[model samples]
Structure formats: C-alpha cells, structure tokens
Target chain A: MPYYRCVVPKDSVPYEQRAAVAKAFTDIHCGNTGAPRSFVHVVFDEADDRWATPYFLDGGNRAGRSEEVKAELLSDLMGAFREITGVAEEDFSGRITEGPAKWTMEGGMVLPEPGEETEEWYSHGQAAAGG
Target chain B: MSRVSFNCTMQEGQIGEELRAELAAALQQITQDVLGESPDDVPVTFSDIPSGYGFRGGEPSTTSLVRGSIVGGVTQEVREDFMRRICDSWMEISGCTVDELVVSARDV
Candidate 1:
C-alpha cells in the first residue's frame, strides 16, 4: 500500500501535469519496490497550506522496507514531481511514513509484509492490472 | 470512549446519499459485531475526493478508502475479519468491485 498525496498550491497544477505526475509516481514506486502497480495510489490535494514548501509529497507505505529503499523512493518521487511540473527543487519536499502490513487489507485479503508476498497476492495484483 | 472510528473517502458521484447512509449504518453494525463497540459510540464519516483529483495506477481512480482506527487493537485474526466484513458489505451495498476499495483497520 503506497498512497502518495501531492500537496500543492490551489490551481497550481493543471490536469495534464497532475496526470503525468501520477503516472510517473506509479512507475517510480513500482520500479523501486516490487509492489503491484495497482496498489499505488496518487492523489492531488490543494487544500493544505501548512507546509514550508509550495509542493509536498506525502506518502504512506507498508512497513518493513530498509531505510535506504525508503530514502531513495522519496527522492525519486520528488524528482519526478519536479521534472513533470517544472517546479524548482526548493519548492518541493517529501516524506514517506510506514505502517504495519497486517493493519490493512486489499482485495479482501490482509496485505502481506514486504518480502513475504505470496503468489496468491501477486495473482490478485495481476488480475487487477487486467493481465 | 468509543473503541473504533472510521473515515470513508470516496470519489465524487460514486455513491449517493442513500447509499452512504446504508454504508455508514453497515459499518457501525460491523463494528458492533466484530469489535463489540456500541453502534452509538462508533463514529463514521464520509468524504469525497472531487473528480480529477484522484488517480491510481496512472489512471483516474474509482477507488475508495475506508480507514478504521481502533483504540486498543485486536489480534490479526480479528483485524482480518473486520476488514473482510467491511469489504463484503461495502461491495454489496455500493456495487463496487473488490479492486475499487481499500480497507484498513489501523491500531492507534
């Protein structure tokens, strides 16, 4: 479960850029972690004004990944946002928070811990992908 | 104090007011049945993400998220059961596919 929320100024990101960022994020997340593409959720919210930067990526993922992976994932995500939206580095920031896998369920099954994925889980993902 | 509360977020125009009421009542009933939390004490809220504001797998998303926070968390078995019931009832009442929903019973 990797849910990425892009918090930006109101009306700052148009629909085309938002769609591009979402696609890029899905690619980056699935590429970094062997997780299913379907499990990655990207949403844009222009409602929050609390961040120091004009753009922020608020991400949530299932726990158990190494710090290295998590750090790289966040960096890659922020980079994608900037590359797609042409936002300056100073205007963008990001962080990914983790929670236990057992605490969530997708496709009617409890999510397996990272690296503990079963073929069944992969099958569900495949089906959702329309494979 | 209530033992559980749920925040259900959906895409705009996916479910109407009538279905939302049914879904909320079903969630409260499930809380009572699974976790023994009184329906009166269970607080359920629903919000909608405006169209074009949500995406999944690089496409516009029809998915909804149901996040439940339990004060004193239950065991994994109970947690799974709780999520399963919510999934079943949500799909039944809302007519959404399993892939269109994400249910989390987080321990707070």
Candidate 2:
C-alpha cells in the first residue's frame, strides 16, 4: 500500500493539477514497483503547515523494497509533481516512510511483501477495478 | 496508557455526524474485542479531507483510511483479524464498499 499525501498551501493546487499529479504518481509508482494501480492512493491536504516548503509530498508505502527503488520512486514522484504543477524545486520536498506489509490490510486481505505478491492479490485488485 | 489508538480520515461530507459516532463506537468495540483493550481507554479520532482534495487512481477518491497503533505487537493472525473486523464493521456502518476502505493495525 502506497499512500501519497500532497501537503500544499491552501488552495495552491487547483483540481486539474492535482488530478494530473495523482495520475502521474500512480503511473510512476506502478511502473517502478509492479504494484497494483488500485493500491495507490493520492490525497491533497491543505491543513498541514509544518513543512519548511509550501509544497510537500508525504508518502507511505509498504516496507521491504530496495533503497534504490525507494529513492528513484521518490525522485520520479517529485519530478512529476513539479512538471505538472510548475512548482519550483525549492518549493517542494518529500519523503516516503515504510511500514511492514503484514501490518496493513487493503481490500480485506493482508498485504504481501514487495516481491512476494501472489495471483490472489492481483485478481483482487483487478476485481476492485471492475476489470 | 491506552493499548490502542485509531486515526481515521475520510472525505468531507461523506459520513454524517451520526454515522461517525457509530463508526467510532464500532472501532472501540473492535479494539476491546480483538485486542482486549478497554473501549473507554481507546482513543479514536476522525478527520476529513475536503472534497476535491482526495484522489484514488487519479480520480476523485471515495476511500477512507483507518490507521490503528498497537502498543505491543501482535501476531500476524491477530493483526489480520483486527483489520478484517474493522473493514467489515466500517463498511457495514458507513455503507461503503470494501474497495473504499483501507485498514491498518500497526504495532508500535
């Protein structure tokens, strides 16, 4: 489970840009990790003001992926956010925190580790997507 | 020191005050039943992300997140049971589908 929370100044990001960033993140995450698209959640919250920058990406993903993959994922996600919203590099910052896969449940099943996904997980995702 | 606490976030206006109360009670009950934590001692807070601010798979999101923190770690089986019960009760009380909820019970 990868949940991306975009913490930005109030009303700083319009609906269009938010949608674009969400789509880009979903694509980037799924492309890099081979995870189900439905498992990716992106939310924009304007209530957080503790960040040093006006824009921030607070991401949470299931633990166990390689550090290289995690770093690249963050970089790609931030890149997409900037490219879509035109936010300057200095105005944006982010980090992805991880938790054990066994600790969370999505769609009624306990999540499998990064490389240990079975057909059941994929099928459940597909069914959730109405495919 | 409470043994469990839950932080629930949902889309604004999706659940009414009445339903929220029901959901909170359900969470506490589940905590007590599954983890043996006292319902009165369990802390459950709810927040709303305004509409147009939440998305799933690049579209507007109807999903809600219930994150629980356990003071002492439980086995995988207990964790799964905790999450499953939360998901079932949340969907039943909130009228949301299984796909619309994400439940996590993490050990501290």
Candidate 3:
C-alpha cells in the first residue's frame, strides 16, 4: 500500500492541480511497482502555511523493486510536484517510510502476504488495465 | 523502525509552540517506550489541517487523527493500549473528547 499525504498551504494549490498531482502520484507508483492505480490513496490537505511536504509510506509490496526503479519514482515525484506547484525542488522536502506488509489492510480486509494476491488486488489490477 | 505520523486538525494558535514541542516529545517517547525505537530515530510529524479539510464520518472535524506503523507481531491488546494512551494524551492536551481522537495502527 502506497498511501501518500500531500500537505500544502491553504488555497496554495489550485483545485484542479490537486487532482492532477494525485493522478501523477498514482501514475508514478503504478509505473514503478506494477500496483494498480485504483488502490492508490492520495489525500491533499491544506495547511495554514504555504509550505508543502509530501510523505509516503510504502508497504513491503514495493521491496521487490530495484533501487534504480525506486530512485526514478522519487525523481518523477519531485518533478511532478514542481510541475504542479511551480515550486523548486529544493523547496520541497519529504520522507518515505518503507516497511514490511506483515499486517496490512485494504477495503476493510487484511491483505495477504506479498505475492499472494487477494480479490481486491486482482480487481485493482483488472480495473487499472481497463477490464 | 516503527513510525508514527499524526494528521490533526487544529485552528491556528490552537497548538502553540510549547504545545507542539510537548506533542512531539510525547509521541517520540511513547514510540520509544512501546515500540522500542530509539527516541532520536522515531519521526513524528504533525500537520495542522485547515478547517475545511480533514473529515470524519463524511463531515469536516476538528479532531486529532493518528496513523501508526509498528513492527509486526505486536498483540492487539498492546496496540489497543498504545492507541488508548495516545488518544488520551491528545485529549488531555487539546481538550478534545475521546470520540474526536482517532488512532489506528498497523504492523509492518
């Protein structure tokens, strides 16, 4: 599970940009890890300041990806942020916490171990592939 | 290392500098005491969400919401206790009710 929270200043990001940013995040995640875009959760929260910090928590599902791939995902994320917010890359700082998915839940159901796809996982892939 | 991140909704000045420091310290200490992570290693970030955002039950709420990640195999009892302590701490600090403080943890 790649749950991302985008924290930005109140009304700093345009409404349409938020959707684009979320979709961009999903695209980067899916392209890198083969996870379905549908399962991606992106929440945009406006803060009382103009600053922004994008935090990512990566479940063990992504541990299989090569380091190169992970680096590219981060690069793409920074680029996407710059594109959407018109902010310099240096102005944005974020953290990604990667941990094992020994206990993960989705759709009110605990997910199976990595590589053991659940029905929701299969459906997410199918929907992403336009099934 | 176990990680805990809190996204709480508070009006400006509701969480002053002193309170913010207290929250950060308490969260880090709790993670250390419960999860065994070093105090310096735990990263606890609090985002003060604006009024219109951060909703619960499909309605905007000025409540404290927490999402925690701990190493696998911690029992439900321990997890619940951790949540209880965390929620109680938030309520005690912010004058929020038990209902307004939401805490959920997942083993990683």
Measured with C-alpha atoms, the lDDT of residue B26 in candidate 3 is 74
List TM-score per model, in order.
0.97, 0.97, 0.51
The runs of at least 3 residues in candidate 1 whose Cα sits more than 4 Å from the true structure, single-residue gaps closed, are none
Q: Encode model 3's per-residue lDDT on A24-74: one tens digit a residue.
A: 777777777666554455556553434344322222233344677767777
- Could you give candidate 2's per-residue lDDT for residues B1-108 as a string of tens digits? 777999999988888878988899999999899989889999999999888888877778888999999976588888888899999999999999988899998887
For model 3, the superposed segments whose C-alpha errors exceed 4 Å read A48-64, A112-120, A124-131, B1-72, B75-104
RMSD of 1: 1.2
Q: Give DockQ per model, in order.
A: 0.88, 0.85, 0.08
Query: At residue B60, what lDDT does model 2 achieve?
Result: 80
Q: Best candidate, lDDT-wise?
A: 1
**Would you list the clashing residue pairs of candidate 2?**
none
On the 0 to 100 scale, the lDDT of residue B30 in model 1 is 97
Across residues B3-104, which tens digit of lDDT does each residue of candidate 3 receive? 554444353344665787777677677777776777787666666654443332223334455567666678865766666667667667767654444455
lDDT of 1: 0.91
**Error at A53, model 3, angstroms:** 7.5
Interface RMSD of each: 0.7, 0.8, 8.1
